[model samples]
Target: MILAVGNIKGGVGKTTLAVNLTIALAQQGRDILLVDGDEQRTATTFTELRTEQLGQAGYTAVSLHGAAIRTQVMQLSPKYSDIVIDSGGRDTGSLRAALTVAETLLIPVQPRSFDIWAVDQVAELVKEAREINEGLRAFVILNGADAQGRDNEESAEALSEIEGLEFLPVSIGRRKAFPNAAATGRAVTEQTPKDSKAVEELAALLSAIQ
Candidate 1:
């Protein structure tokens, strides 16, 4: 499967989710390929940090931008069990290109009204993508959610109204473990004294994807 983690809005944790999810999938013994389709090259940097700082290369990572992602991924998908594309945040060439070939797309939104409003463009793009790629499946996940607040619930409720996108039940809350682990190129699950909530949240999201 080719999975692209993206959103129309930036700083909504697209690269973070892509990096962590790729590592988690690799740790599960799947042959995963991490593709940096974003011109920012955030995913490539994370893999580099993992190798340099932690001496652990989570998986094979390649940087391919713009329309290149569409062709390269289609060619490479047959070789790996899964390909995770970190397409940055925007309605760019690569973002549109990814939708052409990706089997699944995961869009993460913060629990805020602005975040909820930003999905309109992405939802439209998904509808267009599905016309050409009938197998394309897209989902929305509420990330950076408040652990014990109603904002997350409210966001999930709003997500239900979006057409052509399914909502993932699990929500990833604001946790220090995410940034702390990313600094050293680690997934929350790989942290020594794991944040139980972070682990739980990631596990649920992973289960839904698999």
Candidate 2:
């Protein structure tokens, strides 16, 4: 299945979830292809940095932007079993191209009021994108919840704001290990196995997807 991690808002852990989720899926023995659709190339550079920092090989991360983006993704159909696309922050032609072909659209959002409000815009686009690909199941996954975990008031409020959307129960808590490991081009699973929040959350997410 092709999963596109996207959101219109920045600083909402969209790319982080995209990268780590790809790593988690890869570790599960699945052949993964990560498409970096963002113009910033955050995911692509993060993979390279992590690989060098942890001395591990990074998986395939390609920039699928511009006019030929759709063709490029379609070309990848025969090469990998699974594809995870990291979309740009706002609506763009390339992002639309990705959503057009994606089987499931996984929109990662922080459990905050502001982020919750932004979901409407994304949902509208998801509906539009689905016209071209009816099988696309788009849902919001909570990313970077506060210290109180899922029970936090803000988290609850955020969930309430977006009615009828499937919420992934496993919320990735705000942790330094994620960014720290990313700083060195490594995933939390590789950087600190004992601190299992990142891996556990991602594993739960993958299970939810399957």
If scored against the real structure, what TM-score would every candidate get? 0.97, 0.89
lDDT of every model, 2 decimals: 0.89, 0.77
lDDT of 2 by residue, 21-90 (tens): 7887788788888998898999988877866766764468788785555787788867987888888886
**Candidate 1: tens digits of C-alpha lDDT, residues 1-210:** 789998978889999999889988999888999999877888888899899987878588999988889899989998998999998776468888899999899999999999999888899989988889888889999999986878988999999789999998888999999999999889999998899999999989988987
lDDT of 1 at 19: 89
| Model 2 TM-score (2 dp) | 0.89
